[model samples]
Structures are given as C-alpha cells and as structure tokens.
Target: KVLRLWLFCQNVSFMAAGVAVVAILAYPDGAMAYNHTPFICLVVLINVCGALGSLSTLAGTILIEREWAVVISEGEHPSFLAKMNSILRRIDLSCKLLAPVVTGFIISFVSLVASAVTLALWNILSVILQYWLLMSVYNGIPVLSRRGRFADESERVGFVSLESYSGWMNGLVDHPYVSAWRLYLKQDVVIPGVALALLYFTVLSFGTLMTATLEWEGVPTFVIGLGRGLSAVIGIGATFSYPVLESRISSLRAGLWSIWSQWSCLLLCMGSIWVKERVSSAYMLMGGVAASRLGLWMFDLAVIQQMQ
Candidate 1:
C-alpha cells in the first residue's frame, strides 16, 4: 500500500511538472533569451523538474524491480528471479535506445512546440496507465502489501532529547540509506558492486560526451544510433549467456570472467587514444564501447544475482 501510494504520488508529480514545462515552453514568447526573467525562472524550474524526475525514477525502480520482484519470486526457483531481472533489464535498455531515437525524430521533423505538446499528452496518458498497472499488480500480489513494514520494525530507533542527542545520532546512523551502505560495505559483494558502479562514470561508453565527440569527428547521427541499437542487442545477449556460464562456473567466477572480458575489450578504447586519424580513432572508441556491452551486462547480471 505504501509503495502503491508513493507511485501514485510520483505519477501525479511527474505529470504536473511535465504539463507545466510544456505549457511554459510552448508559449508564444517563451524564447529562452539570456537576460530575460522568465528565462531564468524557466531554467530553475527545469532543474527542479529534472531533480524530481530523477528521484521518482530511482524510487520507482527500487520499489518495483528490487522489492516487488523479490516478493513475487519468494518461493520460486532462482532461475525465476534471474528471468525476471533479465526481462526488466531488457525492457529498460530497449527504452534507452528507442526513446532518444523517437524523440529525435519528432524534434527533427516536427516543430519544438509540437514535440513538447506530444510529450505532455503522452505523460498524461502514461500516468493513468502506470497507476492502473500498479494497482492491478498490488491487487494480484497479497504478499507485497505485507512485505516491507514488519520485518525490521525493531531496528528502527527513536530520537533522543535535545540535551544529549545520542538517540538522534544513532537514528541518523541507523537510517536505512546509511545502513544500506554500511551493510553493503561489509559484504564481499561490495567489490563487484563498486566495479559496476564505476562503469557509469567512464566516457568510454556511447554516452552523451562520446556521442558528441563521434559526431564532431565526422560520424553521422544515424551511425551513432545504429551503434547504440547494436550495443543494446549485444547487452541483451548477456541474459542468455549468463545462465550457461553460471551453470558451468560459479556466479563469482562468471563475474570475474565477465569483468575481465569487458576490461580486455576496452583495450580498443585505449588504442584509440594513440591512433593518428581522427575518424578512425572515433570508430575504434565506439566499437570498443559497443563490444564491451556484452561483458558489461553479463557482469551486471552476475553481481545483481549474487546480491539477491
């Protein structure tokens, strides 16, 4: 019930923000000129919206993918959980590839105002659909309603009086966010988790910087999008390969192999640094990143499964 209510609020917040942003930007004189008051306000508003959207996305993913997934697969075999995770990741990757392409197409062919209006309408519809789907899932799964609240109730600490503040400090230290990090740090799997997290910080991937750099080096937009699609497809292949590898070797061994393979493939990116030709270097970098997705996803699956 808490998760459902939170999701409902998230959808409402997202929809309201989306509508407001669209309305502001779609106004006749809403050009974001440098010295305009409205432009400054709009910039601040956009940042707020971005922060809200990011928070909502992270919360939703944790609630649905981590908590609800575990509840749904409570009594099922391990493979069931693996399959669910794979499906979730595949859908996420597909969206990552498709959303940008579709948005780009709309922005290129249609007016900016048209794209904004389209997105505003889509957000409204998506809010309704998302709430309906969440409610349906909640109704179908009785255990989910009882899952998170009761298990660790005793561990929740109360605050102390203002004089000493010891209890307050303890409560802060024992808060779920802090406690989660503490627990994670204590676990053997922390190494792999850190390794996975580090992947996000690198520019070797086909991220925004890399994409812009490739384009500046004469690679076409279509080629960059094609590379992104291919990378996603290769990443999806990890779902199939992971089970086989884990069955042959242990999960930890599979993870080790996967991470090493990713590192090895990244040698192409390193080699790109020494290449004299700009276009050839860009292609080399892109190819390395695309090829690395296979091992990246494999390692991701391995670490996630291990953590679960």
Candidate 2:
C-alpha cells in the first residue's frame, strides 16, 4: 500500500509539472486568453509534447519497474533501499531514450517563442516533426504485439494475456467498453465498439455542460465548476483504474508505468489548454492535445502488460 500511494503521488507530481509548465507559458498574459493566437499555439504544442513525454516516460518506468519486481520477488534480494537504487540506476541509464527528444522539443519551443518568424508556421512544423518522431518510436517498438520481446519476458514470468484479463474484468464489471484492444485489433466480445464510443461522448457532454453553462466567479459558480472538475477527474481516473489495480495486484512495475503514462496525458491536456488560454495560440493547444492522445494510445500496450 505504501508503494501504491507513493507511485500515485509521484504520478500526480509528474502531471502537476506538466500543468505548471503550461501555466508558466501562459502566465505572460492575464490567464484568460482562451481566444488568443500565441495561447492557442502553446496549448497545442504542450499537449503534443506532453503526450510524447508521457508515453516514453511510462515505457521506461514500466520496464524498470518490472525489472525491480523480478529482483525483489526473488525473496533473497538486497534490502528495499538497494532495490530502489537499482531501479533508479536503470531509469538514469534509460533517460537517454527520451532526453534527446525532449530536449529537442524544449529547444523548438524556445525558438518559436523567441524568434519573430511566423510563429504559427514554426509551431506547426515543430509539432509535426515532434509527432513524427514520437510515432517513429512507437512503430519501431514491437512492445504491443503481445509476441514481442517485452511480452516474451512477461510471459516467461507468468504474465497473463491482456485479452484474457480484459475478458475476466468485463465479466465482473457492468461497463461495456472496458475491455482491452490493441490498436485496431478488437476482440469478439459482447461490447460493441459503438457502445464504447458512447462513453467518451457522455464524458464530453458533461464537460461541455460544465464549461459552457456553469459560471466561475460566484460561490455557486465555483461549486458547479468544482463538481464538474471532479467529474472530469473521475472520468480520467476511471480510464486508468483497471491498469493501476491490476498492476498493483499482479506487477508493481506495470502499475507504476500505467499510472505514470496517464499522468503524463493528463498533464499534457491540462497544460496545453492552460497555455493556449493564456497566450492565445490555437496551434499550440491543438498540437499539445493531439500529441497527448497519441502518446496515451501508443503507451497503451505497456499498461496492458501490467495485468499479465
């Protein structure tokens, strides 16, 4: 339980950082530029960069977590601190995997903000390049195929099939679209994809009502906003619960990874929007949101691995 709480807190911290970055980028203005140019662009860029960061971060974290679990589960391993040190060491080494790309994003963001060149053009190009790079990494890795190297390692360690686990979960839960699907590979389950799509629509409907109808200044408005915000949190939390729970029970490595991945996405989305609203840049916000979603999808495989 300590480990679980610790991981959750860490996940929240990561997301908060993302949000802070976005907010910082937006603070140049009066915190209400939701219709401005720079703000929009910043929103998009943050979302994209954030998503990429989340995916890569999750992958690295999951890999290290699993490695740690294997070591600790052996029963004769070193003390807990030593095991943690081992994980940190591995994470440090793996930093090379994402540090360069993240650095590139930082450089690009700075360039766009500092230069007088057509900000929109540069922002668009940077987003495209960053997204392409992220996609390249996702495609290059066969981690999601359930027959890849990571999957093989998991299988050797008695990891369960994602499909089987999803099926079992669906059997127990009342929800329809909670089952697992790899990219486009939908299994023959009773829950139709359409029904699953409806869940997202429902969430969006609630978000829209909160943002559009509820005021934000008065006490009544604050209460409404708070409730709506909590609803959104619950929605996002629900999306991540299965992965977190399974990871805790089956493999702490996978759980941490999944939690981290979701945190990254949440950060990207929140940060990008915050930046856009502040700086008035539609491009940035769009880029950030798109990137975050793509990252989440790409990292979905690792989340599934936790159940195994």
In terms of lDDT, the best-performing candidate is 1
Model 1 bad stretches (over 4 Å): 5-35, 148-176
Candidates in order have lDDT scores of 0.78, 0.41
Tell me the number of clashing residue pairs for each predicted model: 0, 32
Per-residue lDDT over 1-308 for candidate 1, one digit per residue giving the tens place of the 0 to 100 score: 55656665565565656666676766557354544776567657666766776687788887777778888988897777777877888878878778877878888998666676676677678877888888899889898777455456335433223355467786777577876666567777888788889987788777889888899999998889898888888887887788778877867888899999999999999999999999899889888999999899989988888877
| lDDT tens per residue, model 2, 1-308 | 32334333444444544554545454666655554665666567556655655665566466445543433334443233233433343344344334444444655777533332233334445555645654464456434322343444323333234465466574644232332223223333223333333424522232444344333322254444334344334334333443344334433444345445545645544554555343333333323333343223223333333222
Worst 10 residues of 2 by lDDT: 175-184
Checking candidate 1 for backbone clashes, the offending pairs are none
Instruction: Give residue 192's error in model 1 in angstroms.
Output: 1.6
TM-scores of the models, in the order given? 0.85, 0.26
**What value of lDDT does candidate 1 attain over all alpha carbons?**
0.78
Most accurate candidate by TM-score: 1
RMSD value for candidate 1: 3.8
* Alpha-carbon deviation at 73 in model 2, angstroms: 22
